[model samples]
Target chain A: MTIATFPPEPKPDPGWSRYFGFCTDAKVIGIQYIVTAFFFFLIGGLLAMVIRGELITPASDLVDRAVYNGIYTMHGTIMLFLFIFPVLNGLNNLLIPTMIGAPDMAFPRLNAVAFWLVPIFGSLLIASFFVPGGPAYSGWWSYPPVSIQNPLGHFVNGQGLWITAVALSGVSSIMGALNFVTTILRMRAPGMTITRMPVFCWTALAAQSLQLIGLPALTGGAIMLLMDLSFGTSFYRPEGGGDPVLYQHFFWFYSHPAVYVIILPVFGIFSELFPVYSRKPLFGYLYVALASFIIVGLGLIVWVHHMFPSGVAQWMRNLFMVFTMLIAVPTGVKVFAWLGTIWGGKLQLTTPMLFCLGGLFNFVFAGITGIMLATVPVDIHVSNTYFVVGHFHYVIYGAAVMGIFAAIYHWFPKFIGRMPYEGLGKLHCLLTFVGANLNFLPMHPLGLMGMPRRVSSYDPEFTFWNVVASLGAFLLGVSIIPFLLNMVSAWIRGPKATHNPWRAIGLEWLLPSPPPEDNFGEEVPTVISRPYGYGTGLPLVEHQDEIERRLDLQEASAA
Target chain B: MTDTTLTPGSVEAHGQHSGHNLTGFIIFLCSESVVFLAFFSGYALLKTSALDWLPPGVEGLEWRTPLVNTVVLVSSSGTIYLAEQFKARDNMALFRGFWLLSMAMGAYFLYGQAVEWSGLQFGFTSGTFGGTFYLLTGFHGLHVATGILLMGLMLIKSFIPGNYSGGEQGVQATSLFWHFVDVIWIILFLLIYVWQ
Candidate 1:
């Protein structure tokens, strides 16, 4: 992080010090987000393995019901709040400024505040495990009555801590939303119109907008629940005239919209990945961006689809069913647009591209299952079954995690100034792809076979499929070792990369690998064309020519 | 929307950072409003579900203190606007005077809330009605307190060698939040007191 490290060292470069406390650079914050979220991802993944181990048998042999409840509870909460959401946010904070060619995020200090809140509050949530109650055994949604006083983990303060942690994370997310939205709105480089901005920014803006609007409901509901739990209020206690369903409505209102909020950024990443790898401009660019907003609009109303089995009215479920089905249209447009992007160009099946293709495979399946689950009859049948588990994991774990991996692989050179070990990278992707399918694909039938979810033990009849899924999950867990070794070894001693390793047109790639601390020194960049100035007749300069030409001109400003 | 009047290859002008503060502040308020909306929504849900919205033993709230508090709060908005005007005119003495007056009014409104709470016959545990009332009003009161504290900082900063001479985004931001608080209180007043 020393500005003096101009022409920063060529090889021996594990640039890890930039992630130390209170650093306000969006790039550093981005790495912090990645590292922190990835740490949590490992923990959540381990919990899943524990779950898989228990489900391997018909008996609850791995842990007691209470402990198993604690395991899956933390699994869902940690994965959603601590890992996927923050990683996407980290990517946004890191890249959006450079992608838009801004000097920094609009609110640099606030951005740091948002990043720092995660550790404080994240630790708070994790702290629930060490307490006497042994972590919040209530499910992640924590519907009240059960989520209220003395329900499961209530006596030991873990439930209250979980609620507080979630509220804090919600606050952190909302603040990031504000920072990113403002940065995009006010910070785009000259000539980068909204339509011309990178599609990633559009998705980020769309996601941030959803976070801004949807998160408060969860935060407020949590606070209200907090009051009930701690302050002797009857907000959710039924004996005192509290209606538990109200909490459900509030929770779903935010949590459902948040499902798209989770994926939209990764969707944006795909928008970036498709063009650069395919050597083609994003097909239907405007529609791809517009579809995110359409998804946002549709995502808000379809939350009640989650409430279908929870005693919502028939009219409400039908209304949500229609809206939920409508979401498939825009989502389909995005999927086809990707297909159109990769149709006939000279394809580069690099690690990032491979992951993108694999993610799309998972996302399409997820979307199809989601639509199936939207149908009132189908949803009621599969409501709390392994099918529902399969559906969401396909979307979140399959789509979003794959996108995170792809974005990391694609941008690794840009961040670490070197290429990742390609063999190892490809191995990680292969194992992940196979492991994910083996893990989640079978759960559809298992769900259809009437295996209820969140159960520590089940009938022996369902053991085979559960064992299969567990084997796949173990494979998925194993997949991360190669990813970690590749990332670590690559950042330390991998081959050096030229600027613009992907030959992408985004403004960020124009700078050297591992862009300078201030990105553009002395002068902020001006965007002359859209980021998708890709393929035919676009001014695609060879990195060699630009490097040589710049050497002669002495215009390379910083390391 | 227009990129026509632009430079392409060199440094671009940063749109005034102050211009964006207001936009960001307004966005923050939108979220704050959502928070209230969630609470009011929950209150509505809980109220409607209960066989009696008002607990059997609880009487209606006495309206007079809240009404006076409302007037005090609404008037403080005026005082803050006047303070802004005076600042715009560079009338330092009057600017500080009105700003202080606005803070005083906010304090009075909060004091009114305390008196009204003391007069109420029920605790927050008294059932749905009592809980909702205290929660909404208490959260709103926190916002009011936060607004005043921000103003207090601004008021103190105004005495320093140089502050709010031309760019008073801080004062304006505070004023915007203050008004949001006032507006929410008005709605809260109508729902909690007037309707009752």
Candidate 2:
């Protein structure tokens, strides 16, 4: 029930209410991020169910067409800006210091400042939904011309609020990225070399690097868009001799790299989970780390692929296609590494591990389809179709969300000091895995069959598959209820777990569950062995007898 | 001998991190580069796509004021460098004086920019040319304003007994930012004021 105290020095505990407001502790901030992000995720998910409901009978029965646009736009905005990125960043804040054997993030106050920006901007974004014109209905990307000259975009408050909200989130992301980069690079334990650090930190470094470097491009574009909208600028207006496609260029420059921003951290979590569950030292660990850097570099160049259909020259199109395909090489290295890590080792099929495998299934499937969509010929056919939609969901929801859940379930004991109920956890995983596939899978065939996306009503011929897809989405919606119940109940009433619940070998496990005010109480931890030492002769627990003996010596001398 | 000692040289030597945070500063510079790159790319796109680099009937953009302001801004970077040197020698008065001078130069440049803006024939809404012109210069001016603010803070902090007696990281960061603004302005002057 208790971890061994190195010197038995007790520290003051922060009371429960410290979590309700601004607290500089990374653990508190991390929990704040997850709880707030989950609230947003529920909102986004509910909007998704509405989207599916509207698609059920191929008629605009449930909501008006314009309102439907607002639904999907808000859904994408919330799930992305509020849910995925922030949740991952929250984890980064919580786990980075503990994993690297540091007492806290390099800049703890800045970390708190970064998180506080989220709710302020997220409220601005969500509040856009209630205004007279509804939220920005030009889609989440909000490309100009449709996003600019049209009255909904030009004169409305919704688009303006959306732009401001996203820009604020951009500010938040920049701060968090800088904090992560500095902490990972400068604050590693003295004995822990970069090579010996966990894969999660490496991937976090890659992801946060891309964010700080890439997100400003989007911020600049948004400012230009704002000027065009409110201040009589023509940055994207063709009548004023500004090129619309150029805005797409600037937008994709940030957003295309943003795909890696979303995935690299999730992929990092994958690296951590597989080694723990499979009971093996990670195979090809260096390659896995190198692959993230490669992905970050390669991901930046392929933003042009999204601009292919819109007046890009033939040469540019081919260039982007090649770069997009080339990115698959580094990505392939990661997939193989995951497979090799689990190939001959013992596999623990716990819920967290099950979610990891589930996420892997989606990742591989999405990666292949992604490469298919990357091809110029195939993309020209399916650019605005359901195939693109399906492919995106498989990667975003299937991979990123699944990996997040895997991390959540795996680290629940560390956060809540209890294991999630296994039966319900498995059931939640099954429903999600089955529901996700059923929901997104049919869209592929429908896309190839020429079903255009973003339509509230479609051809009668598409109704059958659309109905089935709607059912899958509903199932996905229902799936989260059990997950929520499981988490809440498990946190409050589940059986207690020991400090090293999973027998994992990491600096995090060296401390008590839910840790102390400062993690690794009494003394700072220093690493002496490799991070993942499974199935090896290295002792999992370290003894600090010298330090303990010194403490006694000081006490004896005082006596 | 506690590490939290606020003496400038000791502060840099004390932290677990590189107190100069040169890497963080450089990374921030990269992000700022991307932002400015976006503006530059926008301008390029608009210029190539337009009938004229300047809008129809909009002629005679002033060059002398911006050129003079560019020199003034660039010289402020020199002044900040002088401040850094003065502080490194543990000369507090000269450090504070040169930093204040650097900020005054930045303020003078901003005033010059305003005078030039008042004389411009076209507004932001005039056309693509005017829009790009105003956006680029406006963003640059904002950076200069921020640089001035940061330098002012550094100057005030320098007077706090021993905060900048040696290896002042805040002052160095402000210098980097000011120099970055100056460099961006040079590029802008070359693009928008010179050539066709």
Best by TM-score: 1
Cα lDDT of model 1 by residue, A427-501, tens digit: 999999999999999899999999999999898999889889999999999999999999999988998777777
TM-score of 1: 0.95
What is the lDDT for B176 in model 2? 88
C-alpha RMSD over true interface residues, model 1: 7.8
**Which tens-of-lDDT digit does each residue in B1-196 have in candidate 2?**
1121111321222264546276677678878888998888788777876886676777757687778888898888899889888878877788788888999999999999998889878998988888888889998999999998988787767668766545577877888888899889888888888845
Give each model a TM-score: 0.95, 0.94
True-vs-predicted CA distance for residue A389, candidate 1, Å: 0.2
Cα error, residue A232 of model 1, in Å, equals 1.4
Could you give candidate 1's per-residue lDDT for residues B102-131 as a string of tens digits?
999999999989988897788898888888
Clashing pairs in 2: none
Worst 10-residue lDDT window for candidate 1 chain A reads A1-10
Best prediction by DockQ: 1
**Model 1, which residues run further than 4 Å from truth?**
A1-18, A151-156, A540-548, A551-559, B1-12
Q: DockQ (Cα-based) per candidate? A: 0.45, 0.41
